[model samples]
Target: MTETESKARVAKFHIGQVVKHRIFPFRGVIFDIDPVFNNTEEWWLSIPAEVRPRKDQPFYHLYAENAETEYVAYVSEQNLLADTSPEPIRHPQVREMFVRIEGGAYRPRDLRVN
Candidate 1:
């Protein structure tokens, strides 16, 4: 296998899964995934060096929320943990992009027309 292939790490999460920051007070649902970091260099550098994540792991795009507000967040896989809250996510965009399944996980809206 090529060096890159050998080093590749599979994402531990999936689209529509609810997750929360490992060290932050926010939670969100995964709406997209990047197999590796794909953001600007400045954005990466802005993170404190002690806490910045490596660029080789999957990154997720989330419809995120904290106690008082909601926003979009781009988070590395290492910083996320499965959010086990029984309450559904309250981000407004979540309703537009997904539907809650029976067990509380969200699923993408089926946009294909018959």
Candidate 2:
């Protein structure tokens, strides 16, 4: 396998799963998934090399919130784990994209990527 192919991993989470950053203290619901890194190079370069994720792994687009702010986060699969908090997420945009939070997952509304 090519180096990138050999390193690629199947995404462990899915759209609508709640997850937390493995290193950071933010939590969010997955709204989108990229099979491989697809963000701008400038964004990639902004992360310190020592902590940057490899491009071959799955990347998630999340509706994320922290104590101080709410925003979307593009995170690597290696940097996320399932969120176990009983509290619900409060990111404002989640209601626009999901039908409801049921059980431990968010139910997505009809998705359009235009």
Candidate 3:
């Protein structure tokens, strides 16, 4: 196998892990992870070129919170860090998707769609 093909892409964060932006003042819980950029070009272009993340890395979908309010955010893996705070997330939507928090991880309610 080629060198690049042999290197598996490992997601650093899991579906229920809590995380915060490396350069932003907000935190969130991971709702989903994409192996690489899966958003629209319009959305990607919104970020300034100098700081924009590469498309080859993992991207996360989050139930996010700031000092003022809660919302959703799409963030690149390079920009995220694990949130070690023991306190549970307060986003209202969290309850709809996650059943509980156990050992600092959110437990997603299984909603299988065929």
Candidate 4:
């Protein structure tokens, strides 16, 4: 993270809260927090990483959910808007099912008889 990047993550918010990327218009639950490097500055949030435009800067990247797609986005910290609305946490079993499916442990099979 660059000197400016480090100084851009201090926010007036806490983790596990809901936030929205103002530029991308995507919303997600806060996963991580970043400290400011310089003066009292903005805070960073971990946007769920995606396959495109991969970068190492945390303040410039964010994870958000659009419908069913979970993608990573690169946006400035100033562009991140705090969402005060409470969001329901994902059920453990449901999350496990998704993991299984994504890991290829759960595959669809053809059951039609010839």
Candidate 5:
């Protein structure tokens, strides 16, 4: 297999993986995976958008969730774990539901009452 195919793609992680952001309390699905840039030895996960930084500069070394800043932590292959088992402790920010209320094309609800 080509290096790009292997390294550029995010490594697979099962759902309910008990992954903690090396530097943030935000942890969720391995929902997506993308291999590290040019570096086959690393991997990037599809973490929550709130936990993620801007796209211009992607990827960060894993650090303790309590880490004060990015400089203090280091993420490597060793830091990554593959465990699909669920966590007993629920995350604080877990949204209970995503109610998708579609808005019709600028039609005001008041019009129906008239």
Candidate 6:
């Protein structure tokens, strides 16, 4: 295996799963995933040193919301936690991209082509 492959970590979460920042006060449903960091270095460095996450782990794109408003977020797996709240996310894009399953997790809306 390649050296990069050997160091790769499996993502602990999946697209359409609801999650929250480990320290922030917001929650969202994952809409995309990157196996490793794929963003600009400036963005990575913008985070406070004590809270910054390593780039080798998975990163997620979320349609995120807090009590007052909604926005998109790019977050690292190490900085996230599964959101077990029975309440659904209020981000409008979530409905456009997913469906809530019976167990309270969101699932991607099937977009099969015939």
> Quick one: best TM-score, which candidate?
1
lDDT of 4 by residue, 1-114 (tens): 775565453465444345676656477544445543221222222344442222222343334576557764434455567765455324232232222233222222334579
Off by over 4 Å in 4: 1-9, 36-63, 73-75, 85-114
Candidate 2 accuracy as lDDT: 0.91
- Compared with the true structure, the alpha-carbon lDDT of candidate 4 equals 0.44
Cα RMSD of all models vs. native, in order, equals 1.8, 2.9, 3.1, 13.3, 13.3, 1.6
Q: Candidate 2's residue-wise lDDT over 64-89, tens digit each?
A: 99999999999999999999887888
Q: Which wins on TM-score, candidate 3 or candidate 4?
A: 3
For each candidate, the alpha-carbon lDDT, in order, equals 0.94, 0.91, 0.89, 0.44, 0.32, 0.90
Residue 3, model 4: Cα distance from true site in angstroms:
6.6
Error of 5 at 97 (Å): 7.2
Error of 1 at 77 (Å): 0.7
Better of 1 and 4 by TM-score: 1
Q: What is the lDDT of residue 18 in candidate 5?
A: 35
lDDT for each residue of candidate 1 in 29-102, tens digit (9 for 90 to 100):
99999988889999999999999998888999999999999999999999999999999999999999899998
Please write out the lDDT profile of model 6 over residues 1-114, one tens digit for every residue: 866556779999998898999999999999999988889999999999999898888999999999899999999999899999999988988888899998789888887879
Q: Candidate 4 clashing pairs?
A: 9-42, 9-43, 9-44, 10-42, 10-43, 11-43, 47-62, 47-63, 48-63
Worst 10 residues of 4 by lDDT: 36-45
Residue-wise C-alpha lDDT for candidate 5, range 34-111, written one tens digit per residue = 244323332234535455332222233321233232222223322354323343223232222111123211111222
- Candidate 3 lDDT, 1-114, residue by residue in tens: 644334436889999899999999999999999887889999999999999998877899999998999999999999999999887889998988996666788889888988
Give the per-residue Cα lDDT of candidate 6 at 30.
Answer: 91
Question: Candidate 6: where are CA atoms >4 Å away?
Answer: 1-5
**Candidate 5 vs 6: which has more lDDT:** 6
The numbered model that scores best in lDDT is 1
Residue 93 lDDT (model 4): 28
Write down the TM-score of every candidate.
0.92, 0.87, 0.86, 0.41, 0.29, 0.91
Off by over 4 Å in 2: 1-7, 110-114
